[model samples]
Each structure stands twice: as structure tokens, then as C-alpha cells.
Target: MLKKLEAQPHPDDANPLLRLTNLDVTFTTSTGTVTAVREANLTIYPGQTVAIVGESGSGKSTTAAAIIGLLPGTGKVTSGSIEFDGADITHLSPKEWVAIRGSGIGMVPQDPMTNLNPVWRIGTQVKEALKANNVVPKSEIGQRVADVLEEAGLPDAERRAKQYPHEFSGGMRQRALIGIGMAANPKLLIADEPTSALDVTVQRRILDHLQVLTEEKGTAVLFITHDLGLAAERAEQLVVMHRGRVVESGPALEILQHPQHPYTKRLVSAAPSLASQRIEVAHEKGIAVTDEELTGSGAGSVSTSEIIRVENLVKEFDVRGAKGEAKILRAVDDVSFGVRSGTTLALVGESGSGKSTVANMVLNLIDPTSGKVFFKGEDLSTLNSKDLFKMRRKLQVVFQNPYGSLDPMYSIFRVVEEPLRVHNIGSKKERVNKVVDLLDRVALPRSVMRRYPNELSGGQRQRVAIARALALDPEVVVLDEAVSALDVLVQNQILLLLNDLQADLGLTYLFITHDLAVVRLIADDVVVMEKGKIVEAAPSDQLFDDPQKEYTRELIDAVPGRKIQLAL
Candidate 1:
């Protein structure tokens, strides 16, 4: 029998900072009214950090939206009360909400691309937060913006502030959002998946800053995330929501260590940190396994042959300096790696570490400054335009952002069949059959084919992207941060789907991501990159068990909930 642990007591238990009592939120759509949250109850004392964890569409974000008074598209609190700092705030006027924002409560939303204004400069946006809150005088807004950006972990803050949202990477834009949210030093901060887009090292830095705010300023935080490992590591209280209801709530470590609810148990089991080491090593301990043993292939295996090879690859770009002078930026510097014909090789690194640049060089999407990429012993650069066009059929890529990659105007059927039509491989009827088969392989229903990309969820859209990538039967596929944005269950499904496809079709993968926990599950070998250079390379198990480089150790250490021991 599992033991039922009691909730941990807090010093400020007598005076709650934020409390949601029997809350119910609903959204009235064209069809009907749908309850997004039901009877949800939770409490956070002064300086307390509470995390709400669930799969996508489990009402975690809805609850946060209700608290912040930003419920979208006819969403409203139909019942219950939201008390903040001992005052009822369930229904505030527009002017009242404006006053409450920034100074009273700040928000860091999930999607940086949508939340940050594209037309405004990064520094100008940060200054708006300061000015709106009246935290500083107009004369001091410039320096305050720089300070906030630097504190949020962006280097060369002044220069970065001048750049637009398009100029910043996904991680940098997320950091800017964090800086804007924390600029006013509000009493309550709502961070909705704040660090989901960041690398582990930078994520640690951002969370550490939040910790400082909680400790020194007594700032309460309502954290919303899909990553249970991260929630356990950072939050004091944990609330589990499933199907628009709170399934479990209690102390963070205790609930995760010995979960009672079935949904919570499933989340605990699906977490990459707890379920690492999915790949089987079919050999004696400490003995290296053969290629055949690693991939479970027989005599027909292509593991011995190198399908893709990058030699001394270098890529450079021209950019403007802080002083408006032209400067050369070496994105990938003398990096080299090889992908075996029937294996998975993951490139793990932080943003701006040149992983994607290397992938681009291998895919022939961009020309390298120097060095060579060989496919089946043929140099890519030497190929003519016609040859390059034909080679694309043999090499395919699935980008990070599926919503951006997939055409919103095209139906799912057309999106998957586009590759076949472009390659002139089959007739219309034959292409339709191929699209259906591909969707089946990815575990998506045939009904989705009639719908468009906008109709599907994040996971469904990614599945559609994979189906398209596999339409041409490519021997090598480059998955660039493919599963980074998905929730755990969806990410696990995609990884398993990739593994099954690789086994069935003898596919090779060049997987690029910053997530080491997922790497442990799917990657056969690992290449660690730092600032456009390869710092370490080894088999997955060897690297995880005994990492040689200091940077590698730091990255592994940064994986949340790795050190926590959970009960079976």
C-alpha cells in the first residue's frame, strides 16, 4: 500500500496571498458553452511558489487565465471566487484590470512569438512595462530596461534591447518576456510555461532569479507548466488538473513521490527524468554493444555504413554590431559529425550553439563557408541544381514549429500529399492512398485529413508534419527540435512513433534538441555542442553514466527532478 503524505506547512499559512475557491471557468463558443475549469481550488501564501501541472488542454492555462482576468474569447468565471491578498478579484473592470496589471500582478505568457509585439523594439517593450507601472521616472526607463534584460540572462543587454522580436531567437524573446513581467516587481507573478523555450542552463538561471524574488521580496508565484520534473524541482505546492478538474493537490515532492490519483500517476510515469534509459543495452555490464545489438538489426542492417557525414564544417553570417558597424558572426566553427545509415544521433546544445546551422549545412538548405558534407560518399556542394533537387527526396526535415511549418491554408490531406505532388512520384489517387497510410503510421485518424492545420492541436499538427516528412520515404530525416514544444505524453508518443518508423523502414535520424532527458530515451549516440563547436561525443549510456566534460555535467545537472528519488 502507498503511504499518504500530509501537505507541508508554510509560515504564512494564516494569511493566504492568493486563493481560488470552487472556481469554475467557461468559454462560450459558436457551438455551445464549454467548461474549461471545474471546481478548481488552490492556495498560495506569501512568497509561496505553486505549480499547476497537466497535459495540454487540461485546464491549467484556463485557471491561470481566470486568475489574471485575461480569459480569451468569451471566457468568464461562471462560479466561485478569486481572492487576492485578502480581496475579491474575480470580476474587475477594464480600468481596474489595467491598474492591477504590472504593479499588482504581472504575467509571463507561454508563446513568445504571440505575446511579444513584433513591431516594437525589445527595449521599448520593457520600458512600457516600467512606465505603465510607474515604477521609475521617464528619465530612468532606459537604464531600467537594460538592467531588467541583463537580470533576465541576456548578454550585451543594451544592444539586444535595440533589436526587434524578429532579430531575437526563441529563447531570447522568452527572456525578454520574463524581463517585462518582472520589471515592476509585482506582488504576484504568473509565469505560464515561462522557461519551456529555454535551454536547461538558461532555464536554471531564470528560475534562480525567480527564487530570489520569492525570498527577498515575498513575491508569490502561480506557475503553470506541462513539465512535471520542472514543477517538482521549483515549486513548493503541486496541483494536478485533468479534464477540467483538480485531481490532486499537496506538497510538491510528496505528491510526485507517491501519487494517489491515476492521472497523476500516469504523469509521473511519463516524465522523462523518471523514465530515462528506455534504450536497451543487450550486452554485459561495462562492455560496448555491437551496432547490430544496439539497433536490434540482423544481417540486413545498414549500421556499419555512414549515410551522412559533415567534415570541418564552418558557417558565417554578417550582422550589425552595437555601434552599427558590420561584424562577422561564425555560427558553426569547424564542427564535424556522422550519422550511421540505421541509427539516431542527437545534437544537444543551448540556443546559438550552432546545432541548427550544422543541420542546415547537412540538409543543403544553406551553403557553408568551408568544409564538406557528403551523402553516400558524394559531396553535396559539387551537386548541380537538378541533382540537388533530386537529392531532396532522399533527405527530408521536420522543423521545430509545426504551426509555422504547416500551411494553414492547406487541408491535412493536401499538406501530406504536397511532397508527393512536388516530387511527381504518384497520381492523385495514389497520393491520397499514401497520405492515408502515413497518417495511420503516425496514429492520427483519417478524419483529420479533411480539416486544416488550424483545426488541429499542437500534437496533431506535429503528427501531420511527420507524416509529410515520411511521405517521400526518405532514408535520412532531420528532426530539428521536433518534440521540444510538446507536452510529455504527446512528446513520448512522437518519440515512440519515430522509433517505430526507424525500426520498420531502416531510417536514420539527425535529432537536434537541448533536452537531455528525451535524448536519453531516443538517441543512440550524442554530440554535445557549445558555441559552434563540438565539445564531447559518446554513446548515450556512456555519456550519461560518466560525462567527461564540465559543460556536459552542467547540462545533465540542469535536468529537473533527476536527483529526486520517487517511490514505486
Candidate 2:
């Protein structure tokens, strides 16, 4: 940045909005002082989408957190000037932050579970948010909540408000968050990876809401996320940060087209979210790459003699819903899928489309209501305790949030060794060696062996989870959105690692994720689910080139830059 910075205000920039100058976030740890953000400077015009992009440790999320006064208790802005609508707000106290947070500035967090009160009704949450800053009167807050919820593109807002967070879907919860944020008509919205976990369909709607807000309401948005394609497609300006420093800043198009920074370039090429329509079309044209991948280098690694095979799967959950008594909700109805030796058949869908249910049935974590699950061509549902214990070694699952899955009390090595011990795979010393090798395979430093889960970053914790999952050397690994919580570069590295493991050990993968990029990159065959049924199933290239299902087509079209035709 120049000494004076680009001081040129657009001629009509008289209402020039929020600006941050010489911002630095620091923390006083027991060991020493850590500077998380170093002299970061940025400005957002009145009606622009100014995106701050970077990896996990890049300070992007932290910067947004600081702005909204929601940073960790240990963190504080050491030096900076935060000018909001021509007023300096950096020195504001906790109470002042509370007042300004909702009324003048709004923030949408990445995880809904964090911000949402599980016990509270959706309507009550929205009402409380509106009442917090006294933006709407107590008497009128209810109506305002419904209005804003609908404005956030939620249907049946009245009905939804009465329901709890668990009653609503993932997409609905996000919309509720947006509705709460917009309840006060905040001048600047700070969204931290607003749709990072949403499927392509829901992601489109979320971005559309954000885009329309800026266009119609002139809401100056400080969009913060690691999704570069999303930024390029929707943001007007882009700010690239790396290792807590600003590496590049310019127009979104220019930056995406010609990224001057190598880090930015790596992120750009690491994972392409753009759906390959041509691949689907070609596959429909009889071109086949999915089957080739289905039987490639990893094909023979899985014990073909037997692991999981589902035939005519039907799963029903007894949900004590609105119908008075317990009701049988068809979570998985007549769904058939298989995980053969060393092959991946990815399951993709919006949340509540029964993907998780399918995974559970496969794992025998939950029994199917009616159908039979065959493991090694035998009935898994009828397995005895000892048989189940033996089968655990052959099957493993990697959950979405690694930190949640891990035991904070255990060190990295101990965490990895638990599975080995549980399976009695080796002696104590052998288990240690296996843990070290697993860490290496996941690209995690063995030095982290002594560290706890909380000591590691999000990416590192996820790596630990992957390492733990591979500890048993299982023939099948069921990854449930394993890489969704990570940044693009790290996500790519994990995908590559998965590929390498499959190639080396011939492990089978039942990859369950909503990310089209991951599916495109690693999946052999694609299974698109809608309302508990497979709507589209074909080889990856073929499905992308020519989607037979309307839902699949909509999903491809929902990708941010898919239609723009970027130069690869």
C-alpha cells in the first residue's frame, strides 16, 4: 500500500462507507505476544462486495470476528482505526459493541450451531436479535422478525419462527442467520464463509441474497471467505491475505484472472468449484472415465472377499413429529448403493436428503428399518458383538468437524493409537510406530504428537482426524464432508492424500460431501440425491457433461463461476 493509500474517493463516494487503517489484532499469551493481523488496511465503498480472502491462518475470519466484536476472549485489536459510516468505532467498549453490532453492523458466522441457540425457537431468536440493539420495539419485533425472515428468502416464515433450529434444515438455519443479521438493516454486513458448508443449490440462494442486498439496499458488505471463485463471481473488490499479511488487493476480476501472488494462484488452482457441464454431457454421449476410475490403481486394495454392500435399502426414523404420536419419517427409502474394493462412489445432496442416514446404515452405526446390509456378503445387521468388533477394524469414518470428533484430553499420538489399541492391531511400541506413519501419511508433523486438539489450528486438527481414521489401515473409509471445513489449498492436499492412500493401499472410499469440487476431483461415480432418492447416477465426467436429473442440472448451474467460462 502507498504511504497515503489510494485516497481517491469515487466522485459520488461522499457517503464513503467503512474503512480500516493500520489494523492489527494481537493476543497476550502465557508464552509471548502473538500478532494475528499485522498492519492490515482495507476499505469498502457504500454498495460494494469487498471480499477478504485467505487460508485458515490468513486472518480473514479473525478480521471479521474483530469487526463484529466476537473475537475470542483472549484477542483484541491492538492498533487500528475502524471508521463505520464516518464514525470511529474501534475504541468502543463491550456494551457499545453490543449496541453497534446488530444496529449498525451485522455478522453471519460460519457455523449455525455456534450462533444458533438450540433450545430456542427460530422466531424467538430473531426477535431477541431485533430487540438487542432496540432496533425494533418489543411489540413490533415479532412482525419484523417474520418480515425479515421472508426477506432472507425463507418460506413459511411464520411456521419456521415457531420451530426450533433442529426442526429447520442447514440451509434454513443460514437463512435464519441472515434474517437475524438484516433485522436491523445494518449498514455493513460481515459474513464469514456464509455458505461454506451449504450445498451448491443452497449456496446459490445465499449468494443471491447477499448480492441483491448490495444491489438494492446499498448494503456495503465486507464478505470474508476462502472461496475465491465465489469472491470473483460476486465481489466487486478482492483483498488477498497470507500468514496474517495482505499479499494482494485489487478488483475481483483482475485478481482472479491475473493473481500476482503465488499463494493466491495456488488457492485458485487447488480446487475448482466450477461444475464441468461438458464432462456430464460427454459421459451421456457414451464417454466413460468414471468406470475407469472405479477400477484403477486402488481397485484391488479393498478386500473383495467382502466389506459393505447395500441392496434395496430402506430406512425409516420414528420422529415424534407434529402428527401427535411417533411418526415414521422415510429417511432412506429403497436406496441401493455399494462400496466395492478400492473404488469411490460419492454421495452428494443438500442436507436432509438422507446422505448421513445412508452412511450410518453402511457403518451399522444405525440399523436400517427394513433393508439388509451385507458386509463381506454377509448380513451386517445380524452381526454379533464380537463380529461387529472385528468389522470395526475393516471400516472407519472421518467426520465433518475434526475438533469435535477428537478428544481434547488426548495427545495427537495417543489419539491415533486408540483405534489401533481398540483393534489390538499391534503391541504398544508397534502402535506408536503406526501412529507416526499415519501422521506422515496425513502430512501432519509427528512433533504434534505431544500436542492436544485445541493446540492445533482447524486444518491441523482435521489432519489429525484423517491420521486417526487411517490408524487401523481399514479397507473402507467413509468420509462425511471431511474436507468441507478446510480452506481450498488444504482441502486439495487432503484430497490428493486420499488419492495417494487409495493408490498405495487400495482402500475403498464412500465419499459423502456436498462440495462439487471434491466430487469432480476424486469421485469415480457420482450419486446425486434428492428427497431420499438417487436422482442422478453416472460417471463423474458423464454426469457433469450431461446431467439427466433436473436437480443435478440446477446444482451445476448454481456454481458461482460455472456459467462465466473462465480460462483454465
Candidate 3:
């Protein structure tokens, strides 16, 4: 159980630990200078947690970068006064910034893969932070690294510290970054979407640890995220940014319950909790839900026929232990499930719970150690090579990271048209027309065909990926954390688009995700996994309304801001 900390004094009643006054940040490009943050002001008192909430390009992150003195590429603070702990730090020398970085103000960035060095061991990187900050003597640094990792919720810390970044899952890497950020015992911590990549249970654990830090050490936190629910639950003060300016700032609950700005109103309505409410209301009324509902709850009745079925699925991997001894790790053990035609089955679990592994087995991307996967009443393992090749055309997948999944070198047209070309599905001119139609269906402009994936936003890139997946006209489309990385607005757009596509195309979806709120909105059925086994399975409405297992209830409870009373 998480221990509740004593109430903190309101921000207005206390001296500010960090303050930003009339801040204006700009970036100079080849075209001209563009302001990223304009006349923004914020405050954080000691032991107070303040959140900056906004969309993807709303300048929340830019404000955070300015605070840390690490604004990227041609960006500068043109006008602002930044005061930290009674000291003016608007403009500091490189040496001065270095001296204050870890010891005074630490940061936990959003993407762990990019923030962490790929070639270095995790332990070495943590050690470097301690050494750079001079937090401890060299002799004690090794033990400190283990302690930090363990505190961040990584089990077997000594063994995990020796692993590289690639060896850790997304949640594990994020935890390691948190440990590094808190290692120096800084007076202030800046967490940028810190728990976005984590599962609800793990997110609760990490946030609980941070709350303990605030209670014991009086460390102030400047939390930055696109999640309003998280902002409402974790912060005492909320600063809402839109189009490079602060549109609203006040007590977290007050702003959330009675949002003043139009943008803030949109954010509150688009949040997953409210979206789920819309779904419930629609079902209760027996009314057809429109795309505007953003709940994806109108995908027609599920067929009795099973499009995909798995029985006694087992997957195992051989790995070396801390003592260098070989052992077998069963990733998926006796997992069994079925997806009916024209319906969405959500495979939900925390990282390393074997959900993705099960998806891989279903797709035949990897061979299972035992058991069978049947598609259309045919066993997959028994198919010949030629038959397997033919079957692959009916199965498609959209990976989690749009930036990684979409090739950088390929134009949008080629990326969508490649599947058609590989299967010899159509002529050159026909494929061109098909690609254009697919792009339109996913809500991208026809002109986007000429642009590359790197030029588009995360949401646009995902639309392109969906276009590619549909290019094959597959029977089952596996979405592996497809909308997990996007902001709330973009996520709602993508979910609505998916629902429209599924209804129109009669697509069978195997949606794999760790977010139960999203599952509540998009999934028709839910399968809960933990430690490679199924703990519960039920219809979406039943599971969320009356969860049978403790684990399932824990996940539902862990959803941020579920208990908050919103005006919507």
C-alpha cells in the first residue's frame, strides 16, 4: 500500500523554489525566428508538485528545456527571469550550468532509448552521474548504483546494472532513468512524461516513490506531460499551455473541473476516462455511437466464427543468469485465447508479461515452444513453406514506435505501396491510386505522399503505418501499442479513425497494450496477463464494471484520475 503524505501548503502561501517570469524562448531557423514559448510564467514551491499540461507542440517541453539550460538547436531565451532557490539563473556559463545540473536540478527525459547512451552499460552510466555530481566517493559508487536501481523498482538490481540499454524493456529503462535523475538528491526534479511508457501499476509505484522523496527531502517537482488525468492526480498546481502561451494556471482540481480555455476544455473531453464514460452512456442508451463519440464503441456485433485462436501456447527463451548459468525462461505459458471475426481483442499486460510474445506466435513471426495457433480452422504449424508465405498476406502488424517502424528513407507513397508490390497485387498505376485512397481513409492529405516519415508528426506517421497495414487487405491486423506514444488529442483521433476503418473494412484487430483506459475505449473484449498467464478474461464492459481478480482491480484502480469528478 502507498503511504499518504501530509498535505503541502498552497503555492501562493510559500516562497517559490523555482520561478519563471515573463519567459520568452525562440528558435532561429533558415526561414526566420519563431517563438516557442511566449511570455510564460510558472512557479514551484519546495515540496510542491506542479505540472505543465499541453499538446505535442504546445511548448511545455520547450519551457522545461529552458529551465534546465539545455534548449536544443538554435533556441535561446530571449526574455525571461529564471530564479532558483533565491538565485538568478536566467543566463549561466557552461561551467556554471554543469556545476548546478545534477546536484541542484536533475531531469528525467521522455524517451529513454534516446536519452541513454546505447553503447554504455547501465551501471556505468549511473556511476558517471554520481561521479560527475561528486555525490559519493569512488569506492561506494558501485553499491550506490545497485541501491538506486532497486529504489526505482527494478528487481535484481545488481544483475540488471550490468545489462545494456537494449537488454531492458521500455518500463525498465524508464525506471533506470528515474534512478539516475534522483541519484544526486537534487532539490528539484524535472520529470518529462516520466510515466508515459509505464504500465498503470508500475507508474503508481514510481510516483509513490517520488511522493516519498517529497515528504522526506522537500524536493519540488516540475512535471511535464500531455496527460491531463495524470496532471490532475499528481500535481497541486496546473499550468496549461497552448500555442506557445499559458492559457490557464491555477489549482489542479479547480482547473480540471472548471476549465476556462477552449483548448483545456477539449483536453478534458478527450481524456480516456471521459471517453470511457461516453462509451458506457452510449451502451446504456442503446444508441448508435458516432465517430464524434471518440469511444469506438459502435463496431457492430461480433460473429460467432473465430478468426484467430490460440491453445496451450508456450514460449521459452534460454538466457544466462547473474552467475553466468544457463536457464530457461518461459515467456508465455499455457496461454489460450480467441478473437472473433470483426471484433477487437485487447491483450493487456505490463512489460515482460509475454503479451507481445503471444502476438508474435499468433502472427507466426516466431515459433512457439509448444501448442498450436489456428487461423480459419487451420493449424499454422502444419502449413508448408509456400502455404505459410501465402498465409502471411492475410496477417499484418503496426508496431509501437512509428518513428522506428516507418523507414526514414522511403516516401509515404512507397511505404504504403510496398506491400502491394511485394504480393503482386496490382499494376503500377493501380497501386498509385490505391495508395492515395488509403492515405485519404487514414485522414492524411494526398500531398503527404511526397513527404517522408521524418517530416510528419507522430500521429501522421502512425496514419501512414495504418495505410500500409491496410494496403495488404489483411484479415487480422495486429496493433502493438500503436497509439501509446501519441498525445491525448492525436490518440483520440487515431482511435476514432481505427473504429471507422474497422467498421467499414470489417477488420479483426488484435490490440496489444498496457493501458487499461485505452482498452476500455477501444477494445470489445479484454484478456489480462501477468507473469505469462491469463488471470482474467471478459467482455470490455464486464471487466471494467466488475473486475473479478485482485490484479485486474489493481490495474483499474491504478488508472490516473479515475476517481476525479470532472464537469464533463
Q: What Cα-based lDDT does every candidate model obtain? A: 0.85, 0.78, 0.88
lDDT of 2: 0.78
Residue 68 deviation, candidate 1, in Å? 1.9
Query: What's the number of clashes in each of the models?
Result: 0, 13, 0
**Highest-scoring model, lDDT:** 3
Tens-digit lDDT track of model 3 for 1-568: 3322223566465778899999999999999999999999998888788899999899999999999899999999999889998898999999999998988998999889999999999999999999999988989999999998987778999999999999998878988998899889888999999888788888887787777765577778899999898887788888999999999998888887788999998998788855665555566677665656646643435577899999999998987663233478889999999998999999999888899999999999999999999999999999999999889989999999999999899999999999999889888999999999999999999999999999999999999999999998898999999999999989988998988898899999999999888888888889999999999998887887789999999988788776555443
- Give the per-residue lDDT of model 1 (tens digit) for 1-568: 1111234476754788789999999999899999999999998887778899999999999999888889998999999999988899999998888888887788999889999999999999999899888989888889999999987779999999999999988878888888898888888899999888788887876787767754566778889988898888778789999999999998988888789999998788677755552222222244444442232222133366899999999998887553334477888999988888898889999988999999999999999999999999999999999999999999999999988999999999999999999989888899889999999999999999999999999999999999999999999999999999889878877887787899899899999999888887778789999999999998787788789999999988788776555543
Each model's TM-score, in the order given? 0.88, 0.87, 0.90
TM-score ranking, best first:
3, 1, 2
Name model 3 segments beyond 4 Å from true.
1-13, 117-173, 277-294, 298-302, 320-326
Kindly provide the TM-score of model 1 when superposed on the true structure, using C-alpha atoms. Answer: 0.88
Model 2 agreement with the true structure over 299-385: per-residue lDDT tens digits: 123334435677888887777544644577888878876665677778998888898899988888988888888877888878899
For candidate 1, the per-residue lDDT at 297 reads 28
What clash pairs does model 3 have? none
